[model samples]
Target: MNLTRTHAHAFDAFDHLATMVAVLRRDGRCVYVNAAFESVLGLPRRALQRGRVFDWFVDPATLKVTFDAVVANEFATARLEALLRRPPGAASTEPLPVHAIVTQIDHGEQVLLELVEIEQQTRQDRETRTLDQARITKELIRNLAHEIKNPLGGIRGAAQLLEMDLESKALREYTQVIIHEADRLQALVDRLLAPHRRPHMVSDVNIHEVLERVRALILAEFPKGLVVQRDYDTSLPEFRGDGEQLIQAVLNIVHNAAQALATRRQDDGDARIVLRTRAARQVTIERQRYRLALELHIEDNGPGVPPEIRDRIFFPLVSGRDGGSGLGLTLAQDFIQQHHGLIECESEPGCTLFKIQIPLP
Candidate 1:
């Protein structure tokens, strides 16, 4: 193939795709960068066309491994999953998870690379920490439940004994409230330990089955005008996972969406919940990139997640709903992360999208 014609066709193809693509000389000088690259990196095409690829990477150490992989031709294509820091003097230098793939081209004289931003790494890290904290919390709940539950039983007995001697109706009512509140707290503690105490049943499970069950449960509860739609890719492979945990995780999310739709249903509004699944390629989770991943999304057309609570939605006890326990999302996140997956949410006034990506076994 003629080098110039080959380059032309490659450039044409790269320009047509949505992902960021760039080509560099073996010496690391940028030779071609598609429009997507310019748009994503916020750099001009002309500025990057002739510049060295190293100039764009904020960290020198990262550039070294990436360039070395191309020069050595160790692998036809090498992928480097790194955090790309913004350039100095920029408004913000927040680290972004980037999937950088280097491919040797033109008989090792040039390197073609592509980059995609995987935003779930930070969320996964946060979730892993949260899961560890949850384990500690479960231990605390177990200890507290045992300590308090026994004393409460004795206290309730003592209160009943006192109530039998007291003639004042007000005093009896106060004792009843105490017993009720204690029982409520006990129930709450039980929920806290529920996930940890549950038996782990590992099996080869299809993700769509879990989503379908969740969908059915949600639709059954809100059958009037709320529509639960599914957009699933049936070709995805089964993964070795705890099906019950997965079902609980997906159900928590969908149930929350259903509850969010309550107000809309009252006003005869359009309440829509969408369950979508797809096969994601080269997805990175918990700082590890897999060749393939199963992507699941639970989106709702409600008032959307409140902006004030959006950032902390996955944290325990943070909720946007009234009278919500606020542990549903936190538990859901913990379960998914245990399966080496992560969940993310994006919300506005009219739409809220929660995305879950898990690796295939």
Candidate 2:
């Protein structure tokens, strides 16, 4: 391919994308490296000009096979999942996981390589699905609550009238029971629909302040046999959010952890929970990229969520414990989603981590 001034000008647009783009010759020498290619790999564009594609790849043999296919015209395009080398530095660097696609350009004389960080892609896909699922779930819950609520009022009224008309106290007991149960169901329905009733009240919120409130509340409740630790990055900046909603979300998670730890085995009596915070860069949430985001983790040392209901833990009316209303986590999820954030859980025996990430302005 001829490198005319016009063609060079055309390549300039690729530099603005978040996905890494590189142009290479049939012999594997890099002809051009986009801004993303260098920024993501933590390498200078000039450094990439010094070596072949083999320099960054983990497995030369496998990469060579992929290159061979593109070179021979056997395959117009090929993909490889490989570990990318980190840039030289004074400290430690680990191999970064990346997904790469190589396509023939200039009719097999040149190749176009596009690379995406696997973790970023995974997060974007997961957030997209979560946002979709949350929408569906919210609609379903609202419809179901409305249906149950209308009938519950009628039942409670009928029970109250029956109690007033009854001369026999023995039969009045049954009427009272009916009225009490109806009221309980009414409350449940109201709780299910509570998050949707209020508009998001956004303001500049300090994440540490929210965590501190939750910490004090939990420690006061579980004054014995429970410990809460804080590991905060004080450098993190405050962002726009609903402070009350964030406080409630963190409180629900920490309260659940404390409840689980209440039943900890006698041998491992030192039950603990940690509230950690950090600032994340180049984060993609709900398919939109943000320059900065907040990562808050509530980790606990308690028996993990039961496998039977683990998948449905966030669903309304689903609970791992007996007699639990199961609305706490559901409400927490709803509140987070309202802020365009995500809540993810990872659990195993003696370890559970709930991560909440919200984009920062």
Candidate 3:
């Protein structure tokens, strides 16, 4: 690779961009590559510069045609939707779908190519839907909870009055049932509206600390059978958020994992949950891009979330287990969203993974 050192300094500005950029000669000799491109290709800058840009695509012929037209001045720029080949050691074997933009550099012999991930739109769409659903769910729950609460207080007061008026023991016991049931319903309504009512306490929060607290709580509950593993990146910095809310959010997911592990424990299977954290770069949360974010994953080796309730796990009153209130995950989602974060889940037969992503300053 015969490259001038001056190119690196000139391309330094491109390094900050999230889009993948590459400067190349008309015949495909690489002049410079940006940081994002290096990450996407899973290769070092020197290695990437030595190879032709066309070689990175799964089908180089189409890129070759597009490249030639742009360089020959037939078109000042050309856009091609193509598949990019990933590194041999990449987790996914399939080629990455990307929209490639090729442009002629002004007053220069070099061509500029920018590649954007096509699947990024799909991810953004899912996030948009999740956010919209959460907003609607919150509004519906608040309205429903208040409606129930008003009638509940009236019924409980009437039951108490009737109990005092009754002289017979058996008749008083009947009134007692009504009062007890009304109180239970009132408690349920309070829990339903707890997130909206509570004040968000803001402070610098360490993600690992939150995970450690959740780990301790999970272990205490299943000390003998469960093992909590940690794979943490110490480089993650603290961010402003509600520490208690984060703790409760993580604990809810971890506790759910422990509950799912009960079947494995009965069979003497290894019940394990892994708490992993890393500093994610160039992430978009709630449609806002951040230079850095905390990616925390709580994964369990147990029976996966039931298929029926997997999609609606964050909805109020939806539970995967028998007698489960299903409010744990709902509250957790609400708490995280209030911090401008999101929680996502993926489950199969033996693996259930819950990912929590929050932006960091």
Candidate 4:
């Protein structure tokens, strides 16, 4: 084949796989569109070809900006993330999150536009907000704990001294009770401030390492019938994070699952815990796009979270388990947020999944 014919064939193959690519003339009319564009936009490829770009889309402001960028040619490429409102009579608006990139083609006579939908970005934003809120709450608790903790020790010591000086048995017993109660309160305060007080030793750590550590700990505690399985992506790159904090976060979730499987463990039945890891792209957290992220899932086969307390599980002092301090999951959430990540849970009978997504720096 001639060189020109070979190049044409190569272009044809490239266009087949490229995401929602289209060619437009200087007049903002669509000259060509790829098969992906037709499939994604739910429009006929022939209908879009030779059609005006603005006529098919609803947003005028978006069209103006996109067209201006293409006309200037100052930017070798430009990207705009916008919702592609479907044409009338379509089943849904669907909020098609298109990422449009303009590049000069056809010897500067036309621009090649590429569009890719990033729907996952919306879910990532929600997770990021949840993480931010958890961080704020943790910081507030840390500050309050510090304020109340110092005075508590002093009060407890004073009560102890009073008990020692009291000669009457009944009076001494009352002072002893005061000291005991103060000590209890001090212990609680310590737990509240634990996450903040602990020094973070950040290093390049593999998420799988942390998950494995959590799995080992849970199994050691409930080894008889509880089964822990690993489903990690070994290819995931090491992330810059505090190993101890990551361990604590994973352990908290795993431990909760183990505890929830108490009945199954007693019956010598299978109470399975799955640790999984995967890579995510174009993840948005706090309304910002993170090019790469790690998703760690801790799923368990146990009686799931109660509906009444599911929404409040991450809140301090909210525990579904009897005599539980309710701080494990809350602290886990705080630690993950500190590492620029979020933890989410989906629970139903016999299946509970806790997913933690952290942005890779």
Among all candidates shown, the one with the greatest TM-score: 3
lDDT of 4 by residue, 110-204 (tens): 78777766754445556666666776777788888889988988988898888778899999888888888888888899889887678889899
Choose 2 or 3, whichever is better by TM-score: 3
Clashing pairs in 4: none
Candidate 2 regions exceeding 4 Å error are 1-21, 31-49, 68-76, 83-98, 104-110, 117-123, 265-267
lDDT against the true structure, per candidate, is 0.79, 0.85, 0.89, 0.79
Ranking by TM-score: 3, 2, 4, 1
Residue 51 of candidate 2: its Cα lDDT? 88
As a whole number from 0 to 100, the lDDT of residue 209 in candidate 1 is: 88
> Is candidate 1 or 4 superior in TM-score?
4
Compose the digit string of candidate 2's lDDT tens values, residues 108-163: 88999898889878867866776787678889999999999998999999999989
TM-score of each: 0.66, 0.85, 0.89, 0.70
Worst 10 residues of 2 by lDDT: 1-10
Write candidate 1's Cα lDDT for 12-93 as tens digits: 7676554578888887877788876765667777777767877677675776686787679777887877666565455667
The global Cα lDDT (0 to 1) of model 1 is 0.79
Clashes in predicted model 3: 0
